[model samples]
Target: MKNSIAILLCVSIFFIQCKEADSNSKKPTVYTVGDSTVKNGQGDGAAGLWGWGDFINQFLDTTKVKVKNHALGGTSSRTYIQKGLWKPVLDSLKKGDYVLLQFGHNDDGPINDDFRARGTIKGIGSESEEIDNMLTGKHEVVHTYGWYLSKIIKEAKSKGAIPVVMSPIPRNKWEGKKVPRNNDSYGLWAKQVAAREHVTFIDLNEQMAQKMETLGEDKIYGNLFYKKDHTHTSAKGAVLAASIITQELKKTNNSLKDFVLENPTIILPKKTNIYLIGDSTVANNGIPEAVGWGVELHKYLDTTRVNIINKARGGRSSRTFYNEKLWQAVYDTLQKGDFVLMQFGHNDGGHIDQPKYRGSIQGISDSTMVVTKNDSIKETVHTYGWYMATFINQAKEKGAIPIVFSHIPRNEWKGNSVERADKTYGLWAKQIAQKNNAAFIDLNDSISVAYEKIGAKKIKQFFPKDHTHTNADGASFNASIVVICLKADKSLGLRDLVLSQKEIDRLSQIALNTSIENKK
Candidate 1:
């Protein structure tokens, strides 16, 4: 009786281990498989060319969802399988994952070449070609592009992973004021395969071709593609392709659409420059956990319309910024149509002329105090308001729009209410802004309101080390709030540079949902 009981116990333990291992392999990941158009050389911007896979993560909430790009530079649908590349991809696919397949660029090449026999039989037909591939040195039966696509889809489905078929992004080929589509060829065939397999199909080719034509030849040549290379895309073109894919996915109602960044960055017609000048809270660079809002704010704006240049430095007050020539660098780059966003006071409240010599006089007065530094250099200091006024006047003289922002609130709280800089630096920032007739963004009060709503206990994760700097999540929250505020004030004339109010509202709701999940 004891020997029989031992055998049964061992069997039960083995089953439990198998179940645990199976559950561990079930984490959802998005795998991209294609040619150079999907992922260029080494998946790096080596020669200014990037694949759509390189920039897809920028449009998705990648911190929550993982994206793996397994595309090679010169492989077709036929070679990808014949060369055993697809086997590893199949091994990685499990239940609750997605595999995006995009090819057709190299599929138009020679079939039995001694160099690269990467071509596939055309169309979604059941045609097949038997050839000893020169590249792989193996006997192979190559089928139509649709046949290869179907094989990948069916195999991914067998692993319980969803397969998403994508038509190749259109090359920079134009047929008199309009780009031609691959409607009768790869695009149609890819769509047919997805329909046959009953999976989602994203028409990336049509979407990208239309966008390219709309951009005009001038913008498309130098800005997007590098003129000579029409087959592969530059970094900008790749990002544009990825953005269009996500936008199409939004319409398709795919589950992966949920991971897409709301109002993802895309190239637009008009262009402007947005210069940001502030302190560590605005320019935090290296600390992996801590991120500055300025660095992430561009994700909220359309890159094609305005380029955000974050010139803010860590541990610099407005007084020191001008003194250190950091502000001058941005001022020189300022153009007539550019916008300047200045946020200070986080480091401006430090001791004046002492340990750091970074703080300024309290108010918006023209008060000046002269002091001698340790290097025997005589330095002239001005009021916090005076420095703010100087920056505003300088920006205006250069035909640039200057928008003043009060420093963001720290994590400190008083009985569930977060600390607001409204009485001090916030008040001065607004006073200077109003005095110069500049647009004012009350970042201190705005961030404090959000923090209070989120509550102190829940946001402890935002401040890992101290009360001043914010982690990536916290910076993203602040940037979203800034976008919301930017949309609210039309006098800033940033309507085209930032997102719409409806988009920010949706983003705010997403943040709330994410917070709720994190708490759970």
Candidate 2:
């Protein structure tokens, strides 16, 4: 009898271990259902657009739970069910699985229209509308948006699956410094349905709107949406939206929340300082009519993320800038990751040994000259390339990134084309950047492109009285040009730190208008 009991106990232990293994191997799935903002274009990021559902999986522990996104573009809560999209998802539901439902973007359209009938009645009441389908030519009974959402919740619960109802994300439209929310409409109805069914409710619209308010209107247009598209999101925007959803999930403390990864804190490096070293075109002299591009550059930058210090002074060439102790002041403050933009050529045309000598020998050669100035101060001047190389090497030694910029164009037009310095300073700057392993921006060429596009008639408005130093409008335009170049160069890593395209355009237009008015 003792031997038989021992065998039975061993068999029982083996069975318990097998059961535990099977339980551990089984993986739960979290399904999502919503409109375009949740999952746009099959969640493939087509046309440079993305949806939040495509990114939410990154925040979850996929090893423990799987994510399935069934959101379709141009879908509403009513059509999602009417087109039988919910049936397959419902059939796949199992006990311990989770279903997240978000809708209401297309629920406000006309119910029975000949052109894409996809709307449902509003509210969560027991209301139904009988209509003859124009496209299908069949008599159908339509329910309210709330009724459809409640159906999804109840069906999920009936199948022993957990239901999570999220109000739709708010549109990009803003009203009086705030992004308008769906609180009175779909948001309220979603909350009511979740309460009635005892399911988890997430006020995504309000939460996202609050975040948008914090980001402000300029950032909302710049950082969130694609070009001229306020409905859909860019890749960065999708990530931000998904992060908000992740936070709400944790707050809800649902069973599925256990499968989510803890939100990782992003530790950014100390703010880098940007120093502008150039001629009068890059200085700040408190002259409204003679504003420099460097003075206006800070407007396009996210100041909270970086600092801009315009150390440029008038009448300073690449040679004179270092000789006059200006470069030393900037170099003294250089920290790791700091940036320096150097542009000089306007005053570098004088004779090397004259009293007003400022020009450095052109090209990347190591040519040097001894100049005796009016103050009888003997100085050893190096070639333009040598000076640039010195600055680049010194900055790199201090763990700073050095960038070279060609001189800005002087509003000179040749047969409807803006003349650029591509043959002179531009070429030398590019050569120096390549030789020293530094970044280079051809500001002359870049601004010339904009000028050609704007035509000489409109472009001349930026240059108020002179061809060299620009007015406020012209300075802002040049600053925007520099920003555009910085954004294109991935090595600079400034694209993610600049303002949005919309914000830039808005500011540029304002500057243009203001300058034109002042000139008139």
Candidate 3:
């Protein structure tokens, strides 16, 4: 009897300890998978496009949830999982986690055996696969794109994670000057599969197409794409994509409905803090009418939900930014989930006359060159590449999302044709961003588009005779461009920062009235 009582007591103690351990454990995470539209990439300049995932961080209650981005550039649903890219996610997934999948940008590759091919015509090929070591260099079997996606869904579900399928956001491409319906494209197919599998779905492509139509083609350009390029999004374009997804989530899932940041919150500040660390164009100049994009950026933001901290200094290159410890001030104060905007190059041209002051080394590539401070002596300066990249990597190390923008345009560009960075510091900035896996905003491309639409006569009002800097009007104009870029790119994490239609109309009216009063 004594032995039986002792054994029973020990079993009860073990059960209680197990329950305690389980209760204290952290919850599983949510992950995303997609292509270039959703993937993070460098913007045209150092200060532009905003990614959707960046803003998604704002919507979730961080205490109980975690989000991971597994999206990449130039990938389709077929290649994303095939290249072992999905392995890391699969390995890390735990029960009760979630996977959000979006694709379709590059899935329409040639039907033949091209290296980039991802999908074939519907019902054109056999469903089964056979081992063929001769045809494939490595793998013995090749599965259809649908098959691969199904595998991901099955695997995720098997691990007790919910798989939510979202169609790719539509490109800015138009037919007859109107945004086309996504009736037959991959966007349509994504819906069909979601329905067939009874998985949750978000039709981002449909939403984006309708959004562009609602905004109008002329109004959509700079806000969506930097140029006539219909495929990729400008910084604003990314934000728009993210907003559609975010709003859709509120509609799609009841559990997440209350968590939307747009809903009034009595609990805490519940705002996302953004810190800017860059050269003149993205930093606050504080000079009237001579504001940089960073300085004028406040007009587009909802201050109640976001805190903007600008630490940009003029005449500072990447090297000077660090040497002066300007970034340290921002870094020391940043909280987790905060964002950092980085732009440089107007001064990083490596001018060596101020030899003691330049940031990057000279004579590395056309992208990075040594500039002599004075014509008399050829004193080598730092490479713009080296100094700029260091700032980006450091910001990432600090656990902040680092968004780099291409340098804004100069008066040197004469026409609607975009002045490619060529061998200049701007080109180097773009290359360095891509190499580092940092989010990039093509400010150069975005600004040029705005300039073209406003026309050279109207542009003179914004840009001074020198063409490099802008007046207050120009600064505000540029700020609008940055906001538009944030809306379309979906990479800078500004999706949750969108203003509703009523809010947008109100701001636009306020701006118009302010302009009219100034004219008077």
Candidate 1 lDDT (Cα, whole model)? 0.84
Question: Which stretches of candidate 2 lie above 4 Å from their native place?
Answer: 1-164, 174-189, 206-229, 232-275, 298-311, 323-340, 350-358, 371-379, 392-403, 411-423, 434-441, 445-466, 483-510
lDDT of 3 at 377: 51
Each candidate structure's TM-score, on Cα atoms with residue i matched to residue i, is 0.51, 0.60, 0.47
> lDDT of model 1 at residue 264?
61
The model with the greater TM-score, 1 or 3, is 1
Please write out the lDDT profile of model 2 over residues 203-304, one tens digit for every residue. Answer: 988998898899888877546764357788866677777888888888886987797788654322245588899888999868866788998997787664
Q: What are the per-residue Cα lDDT tens digits for candidate 1 across 244-295?
A: 8888888976788888889665533346788999998889678945678997
Q: Rate the local accuracy (lDDT) of all candidates.
A: 0.84, 0.84, 0.67
Q: List the residue pairs that clash in candidate 2.
A: 222-500
Predictions ranked by TM-score, top down? 2, 1, 3
lDDT of 3 by residue, 1-520 (tens): 9999999999999999988667545555768787766655632222334345544545666556677777776777766876788888888888878788887777776433536545434421337444333323554355555556667888887887788888777767778667776657666777777776667888888888888888888787556764335676655576667667768888776344344567422232356778887776676676665567777677677554577888888778877787678877877786667888777877766544565556566423434444545556553445677666677777777787877777788755555554656467666777888888887778877878767765665566555536677656666666776667777777666854654435444554454345445555
Name the candidate, 2 or 3, with the larger lDDT value.
2
Candidate 3: list runs displaced more than 4 Å. Answer: 1-25, 42-51, 111-117, 120-136, 253-259, 262-520
Q: Model 1, 388: alpha-carbon shift in Å?
A: 0.6
